[model samples]
Target: MIRWAASLGLILAITLAAPGAHGQSPAGAYETLRLIDGVRVLMNPADHASFASSNVVIIEQADGLVVVDSGFSRADGDQIVSYIRSFTAKPVKALIYTHWHNDHHQGASQIQAAWPQVRIIATEAARRGIDGPARLEGVGYETNPAWEALLAGQLRDVAARYQEAAANPENDAWRRHRFGQAAQQSLDGIPALVGTRLTAPTELFTADLVIDDPLRPVHIRHLGRANTDGDLIVWLPNQRVVATGDIVVSPIPFGFGSYPGDWIETLGRIKALGFHVLIPGHGLPQSDSAYIDRLIAAIADIRTRVGALAAEGLTLEQVRERVDYAEQTAIFGPSPARQANFQSLWLSPMTENAYKEATGVPIVQGQGELP
Candidate 1:
């Protein structure tokens, strides 16, 4: 399902057959998937009904837990805290953000409230995204009261749309309605959409940062820009598990604020890591690198095809029309709904980015151009 909210600067696309909602308790609002002894994947429904499409990873240590990706709202953070408490009484030692997307880190405050000593780690670019004005500028908006009002209104509108859609008997509509209800519920807690004390990263790194502990040794690497300019991947060498935030989303990938040309290379580096299990920022975990390969091929295909079209003096619009993604569409999902979602969420933005890169135009969103 594709829903556009100009006020929020979002083109929300919820995928089908998202991980089922389980382990729901007053403490955590998401489902938990235990990959190994100490590593648990806390997944939000991909249908977007819960408005928590991002997954939170929990890694157990000797003293406490290390969490990846806070979530989307204050309520989400509270649930995460409760979820953590339900399992163990240990405090969260660290909170790591894979990127700077709001959905991944907005709930930092909640986690911080519970574990005051937790260290929030992120790439330097991600820290800027949280502390600076890039988020508003990236979306072509300015940070101000008007912007906040627009976002609040957009959330309300989304809630209403979901409510109407939920009234339908169709399964997809019900999912949309559920997502809308969650969006509405999060409004009271999210403050303003952009411009707030967004629990900035306490620990920042440029390329790589390693946490060497006796129990769980974490290797955080910023491979290259993929999903976001500061995209980072968490590699648990011993566990052989990798947490890719939006960098390797399942079902369909997102292309907003992405570096298509560089993303392919970044994926290559991620593949070299040889992770046995992959936990994405959204959707379910993957046991192999099949999804990663598919995503790399899709982006590379877009760059090759769109770059050629753009080099031939074709405008972005023309390139979009000329680019053929039938094979990819089939591979992703040939159904009408999946096709629409893929085109809107991934294809269009990717084409534009590839076209700009090929033609020597600055990529607007991740170019560090702030107002």
Candidate 2:
């Protein structure tokens, strides 16, 4: 299922999923679904009605437990904490951010409260994002006006879409009601900002590191620039497991904010990771390596098509019309919302970056940098 997109900004808020009274869904509540693989994988399906997804990973390490990316809102934070506690009382020793997206990091605050001493972990780039504006925003005005316009237009549309969904009673009354409360909490969080300390990672490192604990012998590899600048994929060599953050999703990869060529390279690296179980950021955990191979091929196909268009000097629109990756599109499911994915993949900085890489043109301003 194609999960709904929330704002990527690092705004503070705590929203709970409303539990329907007497078995009926409340104004804006969705059931919470859990997908666990006996200790390796844990998935908390946010807004069970809509495709709102977040992840909670418990890596049984040699010394302690390492928790990875939290879901959106406080409710998600609470749900994940509860889930982890059920498995082991081993205090969460470390927390890792796959990237800086709000859905992945917003719940970190709650985790800190539960495991006060837990050392939060993220790449320097990801940490910078948590504390600073996305690099694109930092250089937005100083860069080309065309690039600024593109980014603003995309963000505006995203914000507008959130508003529309939040206001509607049908699209996802559960998410609307739950996130509405979150929005209010975001408002409430302003005061706490003065003295409020959020649990942030103290250790920031770049490069692949293998945490050789017998409990969680996983290899954390920084498969350079796929989804975002700090994109990292976690591999459990022992369990043959891989956690692919936003790099690979169920139906289609979220290309809206991606670098196609880099993402493709990332996929290639993932294929080379040689793991048996591949857990994507969204959707049910896929254990098949063939699925990973298919994803890689699909991305290569996209790059081939888009590169061909750029070579012909064809516009993005013209390219979209001629290039049809129907199989990949079906993975996202059916809905008007899917159109946003199309726009994201085609128009987002990621696609633009991919175009530049293929054509050897310097990335323009407002365009995200691939580090």
Candidate 3:
């Protein structure tokens, strides 16, 4: 069981986490967060991407369970499947690819091996994205589990600091938001990321499609481009739940592949869907209306901040820090840490460089700091 803690009169609290009771490091242990009765989200951490955390969701349907995104490797996939098995014996009926990022969909091969009948579904762009040349050659976790383990400790410490701040009366609301935001930011820097052979999808689509089962009727719609050029939203009209890929991570939206204009428009589209339970690619699920409001506010703030940086010709690092993720994070909340999380996957320099060149700015080389 997950232990949540807080202390009195302390503005800051600490959440002490231990390795899996069975002796596995915290990185391999899959912490399952049940979103609802039949829906669950998995948080997998690793030293990859500087030891950040990643998320995956599994939805149980009447026919079989539908997996939203897979984890980083066969090992990670096995851990996820093991967690699912602990809950129910149902096989995966369908594997849904929210986007083609490896962290989001690399476990398909293992899952398919277990459930060959499972159908693979994703957007056309997501399909190609998974099969692209940039695919990982091998696993990310085993590359440096020791160092990754050390990094995971730091993230845990960061999380602890965040929790501590959240308990302070004066910092309560603000710290909670920052904690969440920091969670999202911390996800990008994990170093233990294991590269994967990649499990590609079998089917793809370009338009809105409906996933109907006796259990639920999910309408998945694409919003031109946001998190990626081919991002999509999975909506459960009846359950009033929606799975928004990476388009809307907690604390703030990941802007690596973001077309600011399109991202903003996508937020409007999500709001129009009116899902009460909004499940983001990372972070906790939120209410549809409330989340839509939160998204709009955060994205607008990012736009304003980035726009100012662009106007002033500030570099990406200067630009990165100029846009205070802390404020938005304080308001929205933090995401979990995982290897190859969206923070690393989405915040690629290639994407950012492209965005800059497209906007007529000089290009820069390197991962973190902008030129």
User: What CA root-mean-square deviation does each model show from the true structure?
Assistant: 5.1, 8.2, 9.9
In model 2, the clashing pairs are 28-173, 28-174, 29-174, 60-215, 60-216, 120-201, 251-331, 251-332, 256-344, 258-350
Give candidate 3 regions above 4 Å deviation.
Answer: 1-25, 44-53, 134-195, 305-371
- For all predicted structures, in order, the TM-scores are 0.83, 0.68, 0.64
Weakest ten-residue segment in model 1 by summed lDDT: 1-10
Instruction: Put down candidate 1 lDDT per residue, 274-317, tens digits, no spaces.
Output: 88998887777888988888898888888888888887998877
Please, what is the whole-model Cα lDDT of each candidate in the order they appear? 0.70, 0.56, 0.56
Q: List ranges where model 1 is wrong by over 4 Å.
A: 1-11, 16-28, 46-50, 132-151, 160-197, 366-371
Best-to-worst ranking by TM-score: 1, 2, 3
Query: Candidate 2 residues 280-371, lDDT tens each?
Result: 76555676667667667666766776788789987755665676657555544244444334444333433455566667776322134211
lDDT of 3 by residue, 1-371 (tens): 00100000010111111011112234344566777877787753321111223467788888778888775445566777778788788888888888754456656667877888888889888765554423332223223344344434545665555555446566446445645544443443343233334555676788888767887766767877765667888787777888887776653345443565667788888888767787777555776467667666666665665666667877766666555555554543443421112333323332353336445654311112211
TM-score, model 2 to reference: 0.68
Question: What are the runs in model 2 whose C-alpha is more than 4 Å off?
Answer: 1-40, 46-53, 134-199, 315-353, 361-371
lDDT of 2 at 99: 77
Candidate 1 residue 169 C-alpha distance from true site, Å: 13
